[model samples]
Target: MPNTVASKRVHVAVGVIYNPHGQILIARRHDDAHQGGLWEFPGGKVESGETVCNALARELHEELGIVVHTSSCTQLLEIRHDYTDKVVLLDVWKVLEFDGEARGKEGQPLRWIKPKTLTKYAFPAANTAIIDAILKPRDSSFSSH
Candidate 1:
């Protein structure tokens, strides 16, 4: 019988972390993993029953040695992108308050670049929407959720 099952989408919690200098944090994916060798915001998948905020906090700490301030976290955007092999549902968040100096805990290279220069770096196709959102003008305040 011909297959009719739909592919499951990977739900990822992405963080657009801003430093005190207004720079955004990005990390390079391992060359062997999916979307390898491209720069991406530091984040990872959301486990079942995990809130987006919880997932973001977990991923950022695990991947980038930083603790996200959940109260300062805000949903920036949600994107659903389909690739040739996999679909992804990206839950993007703006993380203004965090603790510790950000580093790549997974041994990947990390970059803190001005948002205006985000276009210069090569990122996954799914990240295009995130780049656009970051460039758009908006109120950047640290209000509690």
Candidate 2:
């Protein structure tokens, strides 16, 4: 039998890493990987017993070479998406405070994009909410810059 959505809520943590100059970070998924050829926030799966914040920090350090203290992240948004083969619970965070420079440690193409221009990149269907959060966010903290 196939796994049910409720039984397979894969927890993934992502960071909307912003720089002091007001740019958002994004990375390109490998062409041969799932959801390939699209851009996405830097993140990875949340292992058992790990909090979302911990996962974010771990993923960012591993994927982007940035050091994010778990407490420095603000809860941004959480979305659950169901594809044909799996269901993913994306725990997104807004990280403005962190140490180290951002680099694509995973060899993926990385960019720091202005928030208003986030829509130009091709992203996965599940990323629509995240894009909305960046572009037309209900939260007043985000600026048109």
Model 1, 1-145: lDDT tens digits are 5432336668999999999899999999999998799999988899999999999999999988898899988898899887665677999998999999998888999999999999999998879989988998455433443
Best by lDDT: 1
Alpha-carbon RMSD to native, per candidate: 2.6, 3.3
Against the unseen true structure, what C-alpha lDDT does each candidate score? Answer: 0.89, 0.87
lDDT of 2 at 33: 95
Query: After TM-score superposition, what is the CA distance of residue 82 in candidate 1 from its true location, in Å?
Result: 1.9
TM-score per candidate:
0.89, 0.90
| Model 1 / residue 139 / CA error / Å | 8.5
- For candidate 2, the 10 contiguous residues with the lowest summed lDDT are 136-145
Which residue ranges in model 1 land beyond 4 Å of their true spot? 1-7, 138-145
Task: Write the residue-wise lDDT of candidate 2 on 62-87 in tens digits.
Answer: 98888997776887789988877578
